[model samples]
Target: MRITRALGAALLTLGLAAAPAAADTPSPGPSDGKAPASAGTSFRTAAEIEQGQRATAGGSAGDYLYWSFPADTGQRPTVRATVKLPGTHAAETWRIDVYDGLRRRQSCQYGAQTRTAAAGASSVELACVLRTVRAWAEPWANDPLPGTYYIRLTAVGLPVLDRGLPVSAEVRVDAEDIGGPAAVDGSLAEPLVPGIATEDLADDDSRAVLFGLEPDDGWSSGWWSDRWVWTAAGGVLAALAGVAGYALTRGPGRPSRVPPGA
Candidate 1:
């Protein structure tokens, strides 16, 4: 009975220790109830917004608007955009594209990523539902991962007359947890959010100064892949096997002396 109780206690301790890892990854909480008033025109100038916060901006019809937000592992993020186009006689086509921190374009699982507004139409709505962010992924794969994601909205096709026409855009990002089943065994060593050095912005007064340009070396997750671990393990095994093979195939050592046995 004592042994059984001890075993049960050990099991309970282990379960308690493992509970946090097995629990569902939590979704990012609400923002500070503030909305972004403007958007950026380039990646270097992309406006940063939080989940559940909406951003509204006005720009020319053909201009590109960029916004970014943070996403966590096991969450599927969806970006919704509305373009209130200026009065035009020709149909206009608009698109919303999402990119991970690496600037690699992420494919939408499902949403009207690209839509064409009919001539005389007042507005066009676009959305891109990104794949669930994974805790870790192969180095070569562009799977969504926890990081800063960018949303770029622009008119893909429009008449020349509408090029300089005033237009308004609204963008919002929403993320939902995929729950515990989406959890993976491993996680990134660090999120893909780029670290900006404050020293670089001390002198400049431009918008780029506020939001520093991409690092001179460029953005990287610096994530150590499982492949490296497997490769190292394989190398160790190969060395061991070589050592064993040499020991087994090499000439036998001299036999023990019979004189000492007597």
Candidate 2:
């Protein structure tokens, strides 16, 4: 009876010790799916790079949601926006456009660039792919240059006279840095093309993200992303400690004496 009880207790203790792996996992940071800034807040001249998710500010129909970011040579940027319709109105429509620092609309290849849908049945999704921004390009052509770019979201089909409908929007931009600027001594990556914004944007606004030096230059995906090893190590250490404590409590004593049976 003593042997059976001890074996059962050992198994139960191991089961109880399996919970630390989940506890050791770290929490997410600001860049990982952090909420977006107030909607309708982004502007043409004041647009900034926005990551994760954020809701659009409410206002009349036909309002535009703008976002801007600086692009480096060899970097491919993707901008996508999801707008939730307030109600099922066939008259409502939405569109997304990508523009450069000079306000020239960049061309999109895939089906994500321009889209239109009604509000009642489902939300509308739009994506603009500004393929690799070239470092050196013609001044006449509207090719994408390594500089500031804009994302404009507009409600396309709303009535011209009706007060704008309050539609919520979510914007996500992922700028994958493929390679370096290949420093050219004194030459600029591309001319610092100025934007056409009029509003006086604050210095501390969270809209724009300026990519700095790489943390793990050799890392392909991201630095310190390998979390499984640490999780497994922690769980193993915890289980071994629990087992050692149990063994110490049992000591090297003689086996339990069998009770004299009737």
Candidate 3:
């Protein structure tokens, strides 16, 4: 009996120790590969790039340069951008904005998301660090999920002369995977990437023509969620409690039998 109990305790201890180690293991970062050669003018045309890749483009100061990158669950992505101003120009303010696959603007945790340059300043730098992406989220919650994220860079505040002036911009992104600690119990059915071909929707969808859009496959296929699991568990527990209450509180077996018969 003593040996059996000792063996059982040792196995339990090993199991407990292994779980946390697996959960805490960190995932690999994005590849340090070649960057995109150019950026897109609009969201639909945004040049796709991988994390850790840099992108450069030349355009007018007022142009909206867009870039896109993929992000997985447990990652906290940071976007950095730098704009080189023309030879001579007035003070200008540049800004960088990040949006999820749904085009909803994501709030930055911390970074110089916007910066101003003096008249003689050579360049302005901006960055945005987004919250950790989740495997799944509630329907109402706008938590970041695994998908494609877009970055838009432009001069939000600039003089009229600076609007049409030539400017060069560089953009890059870095995603850090925090591993199992940041992971959720459930995940999305599929990533929020563009599923429909642009040509197929050209004639049927008016929005596609207007915006040059490529829509995402929305949450039609039910996504896996922790709420469903919790609900089922709660229901089972309630049923068990009902059965237990009946067993404990019911009157004793109809008084067993008549006293005379005994």
Judged by lDDT, which candidate is best? 1
Worst 10 residues of 2 by lDDT: 215-224
Task: Tell me the whole-model lDDT of each prediction, alpha carbons only.
Answer: 0.74, 0.56, 0.73
lDDT of 3 by residue, 1-262 (tens): 4335544555565565556545443443445556677889888889877776678888998999999887776678889998998879999999999988888899999999988998979999998999988888988888988777889998886788777999999888887755545656777777677643434454576322122222122232223333344455456556555665665576546554567856
Per-residue error (Å), model 1, residue 75: 0.5
Q: Which sections of candidate 2 miss by over 4 Å?
A: 1-36, 39-47, 51-56, 160-163, 178-262
TM-score of each: 0.67, 0.54, 0.67
Candidate 1 per-residue C-alpha lDDT over 1-262 given as tens digits, one digit per residue, 9 for 90 to 100: 4335544555565555445543423445556657778999998678888777788999988888999887776678989999887666578889999998889999999999999999988999999999988888889998888778888999886789778888899998888866445656677876677644344354674322123322222222333223344345456556555665665666468565688658
Q: Each candidate: RMSD to true structure?
A: 10.5, 14.7, 8.8
Query: How many Å off is the CA of 250 in candidate 3?
Result: 41
Model 1 bad stretches (over 4 Å): 1-29, 199-262
Q: Summarize candidate 2's per-residue lDDT along 190-228 as a digit string, tens digits.
A: 344462434445774434333321212221221122233
Instruction: Arrange candidates, best lDDT first.
Output: 1, 3, 2
> What TM-score, to 2 decimals, does candidate 3 have?
0.67
Question: lDDT, candidate 3, residue 39?
Answer: 86
How many collisions between residues are there in candidate 3? 0
